[model samples]
Target: MTSAPITAADAAVTSDTITMPLEDVIDPDEFTPRLLALLSNALVYRESHELRRQFKLGTNEWRVISALSMRPGMSATEVCEFLGMNKAVVSRSVTRLQLRALIVLSDGPRGSRPLYLTRAGAEMHDRMLPVSLRGQEIITEGLGATEVAALNEVLRGMLARIRSDAALQGAPGSPSQYPID
Candidate 1:
């Protein structure tokens, strides 16, 4: 493995970049992964904040809702795989949705059962769809369609590459085993 050398602009004393919280000691610009992680955190925070206020659900729970809406008969284990989230997190979200009558579980394998959104759950998902779509638009507000497509392509490739990392193979809820591209 090789590490990319940091550019001078990343840590030059004369540069006027905002490297706050880490100062010149570390630059977020020096790390593409850090920048991407920050962007994801920002987007999830914004959406989750609004979701909690509007529907009493956080982004993780919302992800579960979205997953079930897209593929109604998925088991909790399948949902974990689909979302690349922990089993415990998915299980908690499943329990919360069930308690609220938003979804119901049907028989399947002894431990992993299929789950489906009830009529109310479907309604909630339909109502929440706009929030998710709006978040996407906001993030790409200035980008043209072509640029947006390019950005999406890059993101997909990056995700596929990261998911294919040998260290992640067979990890809990690992998507690494799947053919991403």
Candidate 2:
């Protein structure tokens, strides 16, 4: 999808009815949602690239590992809930991690299912946390502490709103279920 390009200066106009160059005024019918989608896609791509490079993990893999790190020995169901991921995706990630010797499965004493991270998994998590935090710090360094806090709050609110709306619309999944573009 293409949008009429609006320069930064053009976007700063104050008047509601300011006359823009022909190239700046995109057709509302065709441009608005597409432009929004383009921005969303770009952000997701950039974030994913950073995650892949810094952590050596895809977005899905990171989600699974992060969830396990937070609460070791959680069942797949627990992971799905905690990560807001689909069962299949979590299952695949777990399988991959197990194959990579990063996680392990055991039987509970009472014969119930067991879920957990291996020592290697814990070590990997510890190793990756600093890198992830550094990436986050880099991304937010331009913003003041208060601005960063506000940004977090705003993003959380938006996520909550979207989740609620999805639920009301009878969507099959939660906010995090959708792949990032």
Give TM-scores for every candidate, taking all chains together and pairing residue i with residue i.
0.78, 0.65
Give the per-residue lDDT digits (tens) of candidate 1, residues 1-181: 9988999766677567655565445565888889878988988889999899999988888899999988989998778788877789998998888998999999877776889999999999998888788889987999999999999899888777767664456544356333343
Q: What's the lDDT for residue 106 in model 2?
A: 78
Q: Report the lDDT tens digits of candidate 2 across residue range 8-114.
A: 76666666755657765668668856775775576556656876787566667766777777787788877887777779988898888888788888777666555
- Give the clash count for each candidate: 0, 0
Best-matching candidate per TM-score: 1
Q: By TM-score, how accurate is candidate 1?
A: 0.78
Runs in model 2 deviating more than 4 A are 1-56, 109-112, 174-181
Cα lDDT of all candidates, in order? Answer: 0.83, 0.73
